[model samples]
Target chain A: MAGHKIDGTAIAKSIRERIHAQIKEAQKLNPRYKPCLKIVQIGERPDSSTYVRMKLKAAEEAGILCELVHLPSSITESELLLQIQNLNNDHSVHGILVQLPVPNHISEHTVTSAVAEEKDVDGFGTMNIGELAKRSGKPLFVPCTPKGVMVLLKESGVDLRGKNAVVLGRSDIVGSPVSYLLKNADATVTVCHSHTQNLSDFVRRADVVVAAIGKPGFVKGEWLKEGAVVIDVGTNYIPDTSKKSGQRLVGDVDFDSAIEVASQITPVPGGVGPMTVAMLLQNVVDATTAYFDKQKARHVVPLPLKQLSPVPSDIAISRCQHPKLITQAAGETGIAAHELVPFGRVSN
Target chain B: MAGHKIDGTAIAKSIRERIHAQIKEAQKLNPRYKPCLKIVQIGERPDSSTYVRMKLKAAEEAGILCELVHLPSSITESELLLQIQNLNNDHSVHGILVQLPVPNHISEHTVTSAVAEEKDVDGFGTMNIGELAKRSGKPLFVPCTPKGVMVLLKESGVDLRGKNAVVLGRSDIVGSPVSYLLKNADATVTVCHSHTQNLSDFVRRADVVVAAIGKPGFVKGEWLKEGAVVIDVGTNYIPDTSKKSGQRLVGDVDFDSAIEVASQITPVPGGVGPMTVAMLLQNVVDATTAYFDKQKARHVVPLPLKQLSPVPSDIAISRCQHPKLITQAAGETGIAAHELVPFGRVSN
Candidate 1:
């Protein structure tokens, strides 16, 4: 039997629609409201430029205003930081994303941290990374790729709880955060890297496998368990003389063989890549909503939600049960009540 | 053949001896040099009190100064925070540890983050946690239990490279950090928690198993691979009529059966418990050294190492290989030359 193809384009389109609807509703609540994202790119490479264009197009499609700031390679780190600081203070800019691999002279950490947590749409800030690691409260922003992988798993109807999931990589942007997210979603996650001995042994036992090792076809079909759900995040370029470009993209897993072993699998080129851009737009919408929510709570801005969609009744019931406890706690801390969103119920 | 028992007491004693030697050397360099730790405790739970006393005793025996600041259970969060801020400013306090489970009225995040990163001996600060998660630089402080586990593994001569290491917990302080640590040390790590469906299957395939799940005997011996190394971090008290106190401490692993299959194992109470305190003392020494190193670089303090132990020859060789590039970069960043410690020779 052929494995089910986990279509990223379809899922990404659905997410974009949801974001579009949300943004439309949010705008109805306030006419001046428009989700916005600022992309700060320094000395862009071909790959970086392609990604930025894709993201900007996706954001516009999702009812988000996108601005791209291009800086020269000779720009000093301080100058780049100043630009980010300006974007951070500009309340009109709801999300800020600094494309990776800025000039070597610039410290990535210094630039990444300069984006305010409210506008850190990439979710690379130390505090956001810390929050993700801690698995406490709602993470301000889940890194796009990992967050997209999660949406795929969720939409696929894969039950992660109690599943033995193996993540093949430990990259800061993808593998590590994805493992943490899977664990938080109730999957038992094993992270295998180059140093992992007998990597096939772990793969053979996993119910779900995510390959982000960057090597082309590093994970073999025989190593995967039959009926495993596979999410391949690797996008590697390899020689393909048959093609006009003399090169093609492949994932860490041998898709042709893995499809035979995996009950479900995501295809390269169309998988994981599109979901990342969709999540970026979603983050902009989220950041915009949060900004307005905080302002409304402070009584500094009027936000009447009469024309917007009402919250689902089931959620309304559950939230009503808590009454004033959450608000009271937030008040005591001098934080606006709307910002203290609680995670499910407190565990004993 | 009986499995070798890892003795925690002996290891702790040896560590204390090294600490004593280091303190003597530090004093020789600067007579007024003193490693000091300030532990703030609130509402003295019996368990918390016991741990605080043990840490204090260990610190005292290691030739370090210790102080306990007790606050009433009813203390407001702000008041507790104020106390922490005061400790943060005390130049003489090299390390600060706020015991966990401070009154519910106070947010743990508030108390934990209140301690400055330099003085956060518990290693719970977001920046420190982020550093540990990224495995980029030397963490300011490794959480006591996880750090102890690393030391135990090293002392046992376990080659972590390419090892199948399964961490049987996902607690922030232990399992998560330990998994990151093991990954950094070149081990393929699987983190299992309450949500894991087939925990036994994962454990049985491990070369090294770290059980920190807190459940008494949650890990069965039959689940361990033969010759696997086991490090149990659980300290659970279960009712036992045979004991005079009507209860006995146990670990997450069934040690009696584990010893039969494992090549090495640590016993409950006699194992991980002592190492936590030992590592705490080690962190204090580290914090103290960094404090003085900074002051000495500022020319605000006189610290000469004429009578102190010379740097280890192997480390010295590694340090000399970096031909001043790191120091130059650090200098450009406004850091003093003396404070620019290099980590081997990897540079642009």
Candidate 2:
């Protein structure tokens, strides 16, 4: 069977268009308000620069403000943290993303955690990752690559429910979060990494396969179940004597042979790469919308539940039993304590 | 071949003896110092009382102090939280655990999040969960049941690396954290829940199976692969006319048939249940050791690397290039700027 090549560039183009429309609508409502994303880059690695440039360019197309704070490689951990803190406090900055491979001197945790949870657009913060892993409340942001993979799957009209999805990686950024997202979508996900024994056996049973282990051509076509949908997230540079640069990009899956067996497949450079940038732009728009909504809600009193956890069904039912605690909790929301009466408990 | 019945009680006893030895050594050095675990229980469910009694008795036998704070069911969430905050501030309190099912009036997240991370013996806090998910660095405390499962595996002499592990369930306390721990130990981990399609198919291929779904006998004996090691985390109550109580506890797995195929299997009631309390006591001792060690370290100047991230190989090599930042990072650890000389850079 010949596979349908999923066009990530076209899908990303459509997503950016939606983001542009949303930004236009928000700015029309508030003349002074503009959605802004700040990219914090430490040291000038060629790869990092290229990725940052793509993000900035996409932001411009989406009509979102893009600001880059390029710090020297010599910057210390505290110094980079100070920069992140400055971005965190800036009300104009709706989304804050620190480009990966930040100078060797800076701890990734220190840099990421410094970002305000509300403004952590990259979704690299530990609490953000924790939120993603959690089965309940909505995550503030899903990391770009994983979010992109989800979007691609949706656009391809893949019904994830009851699907046997195998993910070949356990990385925090892509594999871990993506698997959680798939699980959240009701897909039966298996995460196989370097430690997996008989990895091919797991791959062969999958209805959907995601290769993101960063090893070029690690997944063979023989491992694919006939008509399985494949999403290759790995981006590795393999030596190519045919090219003047002496190297070419490849994915974790062997695309040439995979196309023959799979019903749907994504190519190396064109598949997941563009979708990642699109998702980043989408996050910026989302963060902007949330910021404006929060600002408007500030003028009016927020609901007591809004101030509490994201999913308050459990607490909402229990709130009826504690009249005094309910009044106090409601009082914080600027509501009249006496007016908020006990709704009576309803047990699940 | 008949399977070996795993002895969780014996393993836990051996672990408790080690904890006793450590506590005795610590007390000999400082007579006033004693490891203490304070459990805050709201409402007296018979099950909760039984579990708490077992934990308290075990702690006493291990020469550890265990205090139970029994609060009324009508107590407000804030009131319980205030009590927890008080314990958090108390230097004498080594570990603070709010017993599960803390009346419907309280949000578990609100109560658990209130426990100080350093003194969070249950390890349910978001940051603690984050540390557990993190690829590097040690988590201060792992949730007891998951930690217990890891101990059981190690004690059984099962090499986790390259094992095909299927975790049945995705609850925060057991399936989720345990999967992360298994992955960290280098086992290929697949987490299956109710949403999983053809659940039996995945279970039948697993080398190591962990059943955490709370349904009794949900995993049939026929579903297990031959010679698989089974860890049943489920303790479901089912009606049994033969029993005087009218109900008996059973695990998620059908032990009768599973034993015929599995190489090793843990029985219901005595398996995971005892190990959970054992790990809790172990955490108390560990927390106490950490507190004393931290106090001792404060008296002596800390090394620069100790103050930094666990892996700083990248930074160590780059230290020569950034002398000013190196001195500043080193300065905070009590080293003079001029005294700390860079040895030269070694590029990776």
- Model 1: per-residue Cα lDDT at residue B148: 95
Q: Which stretches of candidate 2 lie over 4 Å from their true place?
A: A241-246, A295-348, B103-105, B296-348
Least accurate 10 contiguous residues by lDDT in model 2 chain A: A339-348
List of chain A TM-scores, every candidate: 0.85, 0.85
Whole-model Cα lDDT of every candidate shown, in order: 0.83, 0.83
lDDT of 2 by residue, A267-331 (tens): 98889999999888888888988876765552332223324555568767567442333433554
Worst 10 residues of 1 chain B by lDDT: B299-308
Fraction of the true interface contacts (Cα pairs closer than 8 Å across chains) found in each model: 0.43, 0.41
lDDT of 1 by residue, B207-278 (tens): 999999889998878888999999999999999999999999999889988999999999998888888999
> Candidate 1 lDDT, tens digit per residue, A10-56?
99999899989988887788997888899999995999998999988
Error of 1 at A225 (Å): 2.0
TM-score of chain B of 1: 0.85
